[model samples]
Target: MVTVKMLKPYYVKTEEKYIRIILAYQYFSIIMNKKVYQFIPVKSTEVRINRKTKKIENIDDVFAFQKGKEVLTISMSQLVSIPGFLEMLHRIAESYYLPEDTEAVSDQQRALDQLISELEYENVRRLIDKAIDNGDKEAFLELTNTLNDK
Candidate 1:
């Protein structure tokens, strides 16, 4: 049977709070995606877990690297194993930001909005003209609201 051997506490600090996760694995691999970490070349870091429990240990030594960019260690025990890992990988693969979805946006709409934003004089007047021509009530209301806001 696989058991989680008690290790040191892992900490994560955010803007609002500091979270400590108790790591129980003696050995682990940090799996990273190219899209997520961005530019950092490590795909995985093989960590050698130290079992010494008497003294306060430096965070760097227990983790993977010696000098360069440190790998962010997420305990393998914290992650669900086998089928779950496969499922997570599948989800990441299917994500919207995976380059394929970016091409789906139509070029015509992008160019029109780009042109509209670049125009210096009375752009809203042009929009109002178009809205009036089309009899678009929603566009008219939005225009009125924007005018009121200014």
Candidate 2:
């Protein structure tokens, strides 16, 4: 009488060691007896994934959160019973580990580096103009020296 409706990470945080995925309404949903139910975490609902292996390392249940003090917890047992919960989590792990994302990040960083270089050059040019207009020989010589060193 139960069927999985949907399962996906609502929010994902990537770290140096692992990736943490949060499950909540719309993030993890199921249907039981024709009634849809969404999981809400009491204190912790983070699913920790191993970055290297792309496998789920931990799914923290309510009991694991701060000694299980809070109420309004999702049933971890029921979550496991969802038709494709584990499989979907694995798929998300794989998607997040794609090499293309790394390439895109590097490209963005290169763009930023170019922008910074252009701004520095513009600033130096303005300073050189100011030195010449003010007849400041010392500053003009220093500016030329600095540009040459670069």
Candidate 3:
């Protein structure tokens, strides 16, 4: 027979919802009657708040009870309907298991550099055009020579 024990639970509140995260432990007996316990992590359940009744209820796999009445129920599909909920979950999982500073700063740097290069190109084109229009032969020739060297 296996006996499961629930450890301490935590709660996180977002803008519109609250989530209860529970850590569970399982105790199992082998054929030799040896008992073993294992720790589980980040088992989360959602909690719903009733706006009209101003009631709070904890939700599991079933509907939440509020003041002796069934207020609301959430299925797995309905829970996933919240915007950015999956993304928030992904970030939470990554914070626990992924490497530190795994965000790609180089991609951002590349984008910035690309934007700067585009602006510099436009500025140089305008400068060269102005030099040609003003009959500044030396400046125009110098600019073209610099571009050719690149």
Candidate 4:
């Protein structure tokens, strides 16, 4: 086992800490008495976009935590080699998405409305549009307000 010390002076002001474990190999040794354990440590980088002062944060200033604590790990390799790998992982996480979301649901509802009779559908059409306009679902309140206005 190897021990690494802090590269810079800092204070541990809080009692919270994070932990992550990764297994490098799964095969068991048949001839030897022990199994190999490889450990890795990850360095966190922060990201912030500012519009007022427009001051961007240094990547090193960001940190990742899990379960309400800052994460730390033991690695089998040098600490200097870990940042680049962590940055790549961050980039990949930033690019993922679910293409069909809530916007698509509203669009589908609009298309289905076309199949109903225009004369009979006018009240429903008005109610749905009023709901969207007021950002509220109380169709009866909107109808009452509309009737009172005239």
Q: Model 1, range 63-133, lDDT digits (tens) per residue?
A: 32111344453333433342344343233323222232344466767987777766733677678778889
Candidate number with greatest lDDT: 2
Candidates arranged by TM-score, highest first: 2, 3, 1, 4
What lDDT tens digits, residue by residue, belong to model 2 across residues 37-124? 6655555577787776776665445512111243234445555556777677777777566354678899999999999988988888
Per-model RMSD to reference: 16.2, 11.7, 15.0, 16.1
Q: TM-score of the candidate numbered 2? A: 0.47
Show the lowest summed lDDT stretch of 10 residues, model 4: 23-32
**Residues 33-75, candidate 3, lDDT per residue (tens digit)?**
2333333222324434332232334334432212223233334
* Residue 122 lDDT, candidate 4, scale 0-100: 69
The best candidate in terms of TM-score: 2
The alpha-carbon lDDT assigned to residue 61 of candidate 4 equals: 39
Q: What is the lDDT, from 0 to 100, of the residue 24 in candidate 2?
A: 69
Better model by lDDT: candidate 2 vs candidate 4: 2
Of candidates 3 and 2, the better by TM-score: 2
Please provide TM-scores, in order, for all candidate models, with all chains considered together.
Answer: 0.20, 0.47, 0.32, 0.18
| TM-score of candidate 3 relative to the true fold | 0.32
List the candidates ranked by lDDT, beginning with the highest: 2, 3, 1, 4
lDDT of 4 by residue, 39-130 (tens): 21234322232222222223333232222252334322333244443343233333232234568888887776765545445665677677
Give the poorly placed runs of model 2, Cα more than 4 Å off: 63-78, 98-150
Clashing pairs in 1: none
Report clash pairs, candidate 2.
none
How big is the positional error of residue 86 in model 1, measured in Å on the Cα after superposition?
58
